[model samples]
Target: MSLPETMQLSLGPVLFYWTRERYADFYREAADWPVEIVYLGESVCSRRRDMKLDDWLGLGRELTQSGKQVVLSSQTLIESEADLRDLRRLCDNGEFRIEANDQSALQRLSAARLPFVAGAALNLYNPATIAVMARAGMQRWHAPVEMSRNDLARLLADCRSEGLDQPCEVFAHGHLPLAWSSRCFTARHHRKPKDRCQFVCRQHPEGLALRSQESKEVFTLNGIQTLSGACQDLRHEVSDMAGMGVGVARLSPRAEGMAGVVAAFDAARRGELSAPDPLALVEAEICDGYWHARPGMDNSRATTAP
Candidate 1:
C-alpha cells in the first residue's frame, strides 16, 4: 500500500510484566486512545506467562472491535522448535497481520504470503532488502531504534523509486531495545540459565537495571536482551519525523503515564501542542547520538531526545 501523509500512532508491544488483568485492561483503555495500530504478544522470553496465545488473540479481537489495527508479534532470536512453530502460527493466522522480529520469522512470513510488519529486531538497512521484503508481502517496515533521519530519507526515496509501497514506522519513544541474546541475562545475573530462568525477567517489570563500572546506571537487562537505561524520547522530534516522511511513530509501553505521551505526540502532529522539555522526566538520559551514528550513549543538546 502507498504511504500516507497523515500522522499515525502505534503502541508497540509491552516488553515488561503486568498481571493478565492489567494487560487486558491496558488494551481495553487503549480503545479510547488515538493510537492507530497496536502490536500484541510476548516478544521477549517465552517464560513470560502473564498471557498466552489464546488470551492474546482474544485481546486482539477486542482491540480490532475498537477500530484499531492489531498485529501479533513473533519472538526474536528463536532457539527451539516451539518458537518456530509459534512464529508459523502467527504468520499463518489470516485474522491479523504478523510482526516478524527475526529473519527466521521473516522467512516463514515470506513463504506464507502474509503482508507483515518487519519488526525492529531485523537489521533491514538498505533499499534492496526493503524492496525484496515488500515484494515478498511486507506491508510495513519499522526502523530500528538507532536509524537516523538522513538514512531514512534515502530509504524512503529508494522505496519510491523501486515502486515498493510500505509504511515506515520509527521507534519514536520508549527504552531503546539494544540487543537480544540466546541466554537469559536477567535470569543469569540471578544465577540461572535459559531452561531454568524461573521467569525472573517478569518480576522486574521494566527489566533489571544494569550500571557501569563507575556505578553509573547505564543499561537494563530483560530476559536475554540488553537495553538503554534511558527510554528513547522522540517527543521533540515529531516535526522532524513528519517532515522526513515518517508514516507512524511507535510509542513503546511504559509502566505508567503513557496517555499523556500519546496526547503530546498527537497534539504536536496536529500543531496543537508546545513544550520546552516534552519528555522531560521520562528518559534516564537522552541519547539521539546512536540515531546519528555517534556514540550510542552521547546526548545532543542541538537535537537531543528526552
Candidate 2:
C-alpha cells in the first residue's frame, strides 16, 4: 500500500541469538524491503556477542546509506560495567538515532544532549512519564507492549494537552517482550548456567517456546528475556493506529519470512490487503488482546480498522 510518508513502517532489532553472517545477511535483504526505519542492535542478552558495537555501527551506516533511517537499540537489561560501557558507545556513536531500552541508556542520552527513542522496556505508562522523557530529549517513544489502543489514545491526548507532541511508535508485530531477568531461562532449560551455557540460544533462532503443564504454549525464552508464547500481529489495527496519529509501526525481526512480513504490512497499509491474521504468517497462535486492554495472553477478542 502507498502509505503517506508520515506513516513509517519500521523494523525492530533482532531479539534472539544469530550468527554474525546471518545477522548481516538479514539486514542486507532488508535494505530492499519496504521498511522505512530499521533498528539495529542486540536488545536482549549482553552475552550474545555475535555482533559488537563497531559491527552494529557499520551495519547501521550501510542501512542508512540504503535510504533507511537506522537506530541503535541498547541492551534491555544492563548487568555489568561492560554492558554500560557498550551502551555508552551506542549512545555516543552520533551517526544514528539511539533507542534507549532502559533507564541507564536514557540517562546517558539525556545527559549527553542526544536525542533518542524511548524503547518499550522503559516503562512509559502515562503521559507524565512521557513528558519527562520528552524534556530529556526523547524524540519518539515506543509504547509499552501491554498498552491498549485506548490506552495509547488517552496518553496521546493527555500529552497533547500539555503541548508535548513527541511522536509515538507502536510495537505492531512480533512476540510480545514480557520481562527480563538476571538469569537466563534458555540456559536454565538446557541445565547450564548463564555464564557457562555454551551459547545454546543459537539453536533457537526464534526463541525456545515454553509450554504449561496442561500442554498449552505459555512463553518463549530467549536468553534472559521472556516473551509471549503467541506472536503479536496488529496488522488489523493499521487504520486504527494511523487514525490515532501513530508515527511509526514496528515489526520485530524474526529469523525467517521477514520479507513476507514486511511486504504484508506494506501492502496492508496501502489498502491492498486486509492485515492478514498474524497467526497465518507464523507457527505460533496470534494475539491482539493487549491492544484491547485485556490480558496479554487473551486472544479471545480483537478489533480491526472499520
Candidate 3:
C-alpha cells in the first residue's frame, strides 16, 4: 500500500486573515504534523497586517527547528512601493527558501541567485515557461489551479524530453484561489472604501461567502482575493498526480479541522485509506472539473453534469 516514494505533503500559507495568536498557534500545531514542507507568510493582501514579516520568520524558524522545510511566500499582487519593499525583505532574508507568488518576487529571487518555488499564481502554462523558470532558478513549481491532468502530463513529458528536472507541486486541498482584484470586495461589502476600510475582513475568519440572487453559493471574497465557493478536493487524484511525477502535494491551511484533513491526506498517500469525500469537510458544494479539463465548477456530483 505504499504511495510514490517521491510524494511529499506540503502545508501552504494561510490564506485567511487570522489573529496573530491563532496564526502562531496554527503553525505551532503544524510543527508536529506529517507534512514535510511548510509555506509561510501573507500572500493575498498587503492590508492584512495582523501578522508581520518578523512574526512569520520567527514562526518559520520554529518550524525549521522542528525539521520541516519552510518556504516564505510573497504576496500575489504588488500594488504599492511598500509592498515591493516588503517583498524585497522577504527575498533578502537569506534563510528559508522563497515561494514567488508574483513575478516581481521571481525576478528578485532570480537576480540574487536564490532558488525559489514558483507559486500557482505565476500561470506557468507550457514547458517553455517552465524551462525559463528553471533557468531562473525555480527549484520547484506549483502548477496553476486551473491546469488539467492531461495538460500537466503533456507538459511534464515535454519537460522530461528537454531534460528539465525541476520538481512540481499541486494544490491538492482547500478553497481554490480563483482570482485577485485591486478593489477591496470585503470593504465594499461593509460599505467602506479600499483605502479607509477598517479591516472588516477579519470579521469573516474564512472570508465572506457570496451567493447568487437565487441563494446559490457562487464565490467567497477575502479582501481582494476571489475564491471558489466550493473547496477543491483532489485527494481522489493523488495517484494520478504521482503518476505524473509530482513531487509534492500542497494542502492549503483552513481554520478548523485541519488535523483531520492532514491525517486523511497522509493516510491516502500511504495507501491506508481512500480520499475522504471533500463535501464532508466543507459546507459548500465540491468541484474537480478543472482537473478534468471541464468547467471549473463542475464536479461529477454537481447539477450541471454533461
Candidate 4:
C-alpha cells in the first residue's frame, strides 16, 4: 500500500512518571522531531508533581514556537478535588487546546464551549457517540487502544454517512494504556499505601513490567495506569489508516530511542518504504494485533516497515 501523503505524526503525553529534568529534556528533543502535534501534561496519577501545569504550559509554548502544534492533555482518572482543580486549570489555560481524557474533562471543556481532542480513554465506540462528542465541541477523537482497524473503518464510514467531519487520531505506537485505577499499583507493588507511597513510579521510567505466573510478560504497571506489556507499532498500517481517513498517528513517549521511533513513522508516512522497522529500536516486545483485529498482544503480521 502506498503511504498517505497527509497523515501526520503526533507525540502523546508522557504516561510514566519522570523527573522534571527528564520531562523538560524529552520535550526539548521532541521540539525538533517530525511530529506535527505534541500533547503535553501529566495524564496519569495526580501525585506526579514533577511538572505542573505551568511547566507543561512553558514547554508547550517552546514547542509551539519550534513549529509544533501543542495540546494540553487532562488526567484520565479524576479521583479527588485536587484532580478536579487541575482539570479546571488545564481547561482554563488560554493559550493551547486540551485533550479530554475523562468525562470530567469533557464536561469542563464542553461547558466552556472550547474545541478539544477526545482522548482514547473516552471510550467513543460508534459514529453516533462521536457525533455526540462532535456536537459537544470535540474537534478530533482518538480511537480506543483496543479498537480494531475493521471497527474503526466501519465507524469512520458511519460518520461519513451521517455527515460528521471530525478528524480521527489513532494510537499508532507505544505501550497501549489499557486501564486506570484509583489505587496506585506501583505503590502497592512496594507494599506501600497509596497515600504515603514515596513517588517510586519515577524510578521506573518505562514502567514496572508485570509477568505472568509462568514468568511471561503480561502488563506494565505505571502508577495508576496499566499499559500493555508489549509496545504497539503501526508503522505498517500508516497507509491503511490514511485510507480510512485517519488524520493523525499518535506515538506515546518512551524513556529512550523516541527520536528514531518518530523518524521511522515519519519516513513511512513520506513513502520511505526502505526505512527500518521501528520495533527494532524499541526495548519492549512489539505487537500490532489490535490493528489487525485480533488480541491486543497478538503480532501475527510481519514486523518489517512497509
TM-scores of the candidates in the order shown: 0.92, 0.95, 0.95, 0.95
Tell me the tens digit of each residue's lDDT in model 3 across 61-157: 9999999999999999999999999999999997899999988999999999999999999999888999999999999999989999899899888
Candidate 2 on 148-236: residue-level lDDT in tens? 99988988888889898888899988899999999999999999998999999999999998999987778999999999998888886
Q: Residue-wise lDDT of candidate 1 within 23-118, one digit each (tens)?
A: 977888888899999999988777776687888899999999989999998888788888788777777777888899989888987886777899
TM-score for candidate 2, please give it: 0.95
What are the clashing pairs of model 3?
none
Q: Candidate 1 — which residues are off by over 4 angstroms?
A: 1-5, 278-283, 302-306
Off by over 4 Å in 2: 1-4, 275-279, 300-306
RMSD of each: 3.0, 2.3, 2.0, 2.0
- The better candidate by TM-score, 1 or 2, is 2
Give the whole-model CA lDDT for all candidates, comma-separated. 0.80, 0.87, 0.88, 0.89
Best-matching candidate per lDDT? 4
Off by over 4 Å in 3: 275-279, 301-306
The weakest ten consecutive residues by lDDT in model 4 span 272-281
Which pairs clash (backbone N, Cα, C closer than 3 Å) in model 4?
A: none
Model 1, position 109, has a per-residue lDDT of 78
Report the poorest 10 consecutive residues by lDDT, candidate 1.
275-284
